[model samples]
Target: MATTKSSSYHHGDLRHAVLTAALEVIATEGPGALSLRDLARRAGVSHAAPAHHFKDRTGLLTAIAAEGFDLLADALADAPDLRERGVRYVRFGVEHPAHFQVMFLPDLLRGDDAALLAARARAGGELRAGVTGMPEGGRGDDARLAGIAAWSLAHGFATLLLSENLREPVGERDPEEIFRALAELLF
Candidate 1:
């Protein structure tokens, strides 16, 4: 574990550390437990230090959500196919349990910030564009719907898994197979 004293307060990465610590708080204690002061303390910075990077709690959360979307976009981009993107999203949610929890639970974070909204839109656009580029259909509403459907399915599956709602034996089948099965059953 990296000691707080070893971390540079004046370094360019302090903001990132604060955000990362805030995420840890959110994951372990729920978003309600997250606070600028607490994050600063955890990062071994003064209480007022977070204020230098984030105007308030909202700013901090907005940054976290933006970071989440950027990561999601990258994960989606790396997938080889539409189905693979869905699998990748599920994988990302599982791997980034903290970000995934806060990103979807809008009640846990500030969802009203303009910057956050723009970042979310950019991520959404990236997902939609990836789907639109697929050979399955032409770009536009159809492709957008495909993107939405894919995202919804993956998100729902991930949420269910996190909540332990899907107790069925989902072994060896892989996420793609499960996704296809769900799509066939629902849509």
Candidate 2:
């Protein structure tokens, strides 16, 4: 049974509910369809209730982008090896396409949002650590360059994979497997 939340947001979990609904909406429809009224309706709250959680549309998008980055950071941090982290980054993008899409689309979010900026920093630090973890005197611009290279490859591959643009003949191996193999070869 669904319990009704009180009108007062401070009395319940309306804020989190609204955010979750918003993410689902954006993931399915993309950011173009996002609105506070839509989110409120989806969350079964008054239109004004969203204002209590998100000051405006930008605030909501900012929160979504921050959530995406935080998730990416956590996934990257869990990998015990640089190559594994690269694979995990690609997997995160593949699994969280909507989050991945909005996180990189700068125009959908407030660039100056503190939470977004901090989350981005955390994600970058994880990527950079993976870069610097490379063996054999991984101490120079090489590590930084390797990080950037890995990130670009994983992001590009994930994007292409999500779009199914890499569909090949029946003789081809798994798309992700092929992509990872190429990543190992090139990076």
Candidate 3:
């Protein structure tokens, strides 16, 4: 007979473990299924453990959204051109579906979170930077509109691909290659 340990977390790492477990759950069951109790169970910790790091489900989801934005910034940071950045944006959405889904659903996150605000700004800046021939000074309406257009294109394509709406039309074709061709045609 074997006995299971009540808690598996080591010293000072419970928060990390919980977040990892939360992401796993999101990947497997979707963000709608996330709950602190469920995450705590998945992390092999006490039901109250997650409260130490996140006040509630909104806090946890906000943190995930913030982290997602930071990851998006990093992914777009090294792109050599606008088209490459667009491709990377779609790639990030496809690869990190759990994060991508949570990051965009405003109702599921804490809109007032400072970390989330800052990360959102960073991601927005990265996207704006990828646009060519913007005004020399601060972003103008034209630049902002361009950024929105680019984002819409990448996001729309990624969403379709993830939903399998393009499977038949895109048979034997890589999403990234298709995105590259589309970017060439548009930009």
Number of the top candidate by lDDT? 3
What candidate 3 gets wrong by more than 4 Å, as runs, is 1-8, 132-141
lDDT of 2 at 107: 83
Model 3: residue 62 alpha-carbon error in angstroms: 0.4
State the lDDT of candidate 2 residue by residue for 1-187, as single tens digits. 1124564254688877777777777767888888898777776777898898779998888888899999999999967767778788878887787788889989878999899999999999998887776774643456667777888888887787777776653136665576668777875
lDDT of 2 at 43: 68
Off by over 4 Å in 2: 1-11, 136-141, 169-175
Q: What residue pairs clash in candidate 2, if any at all?
A: none
**Residue-level error in angstroms, candidate 3, position 144:** 1.9
Least well predicted 10-residue stretch by lDDT in candidate 2 = 1-10
lDDT of 3 by residue, 1-187 (tens): 1112233466566777777777777877889899998777777777887898998999999999999999999999968877888899999988888888889999999999999999999998888888754444433457767778888999999999887899998899988999999977876
Worst 10 residues of 1 by lDDT: 1-10
lDDT of 1 by residue, 12-116 (tens): 677878887887777778777878887877888889988998888877777788788878888877556566677777888878877887777676567777767
Top model number, TM-score: 3
Error of 1 at 117 (Å): 3.7
Output the TM-score of candidate 2: 0.86
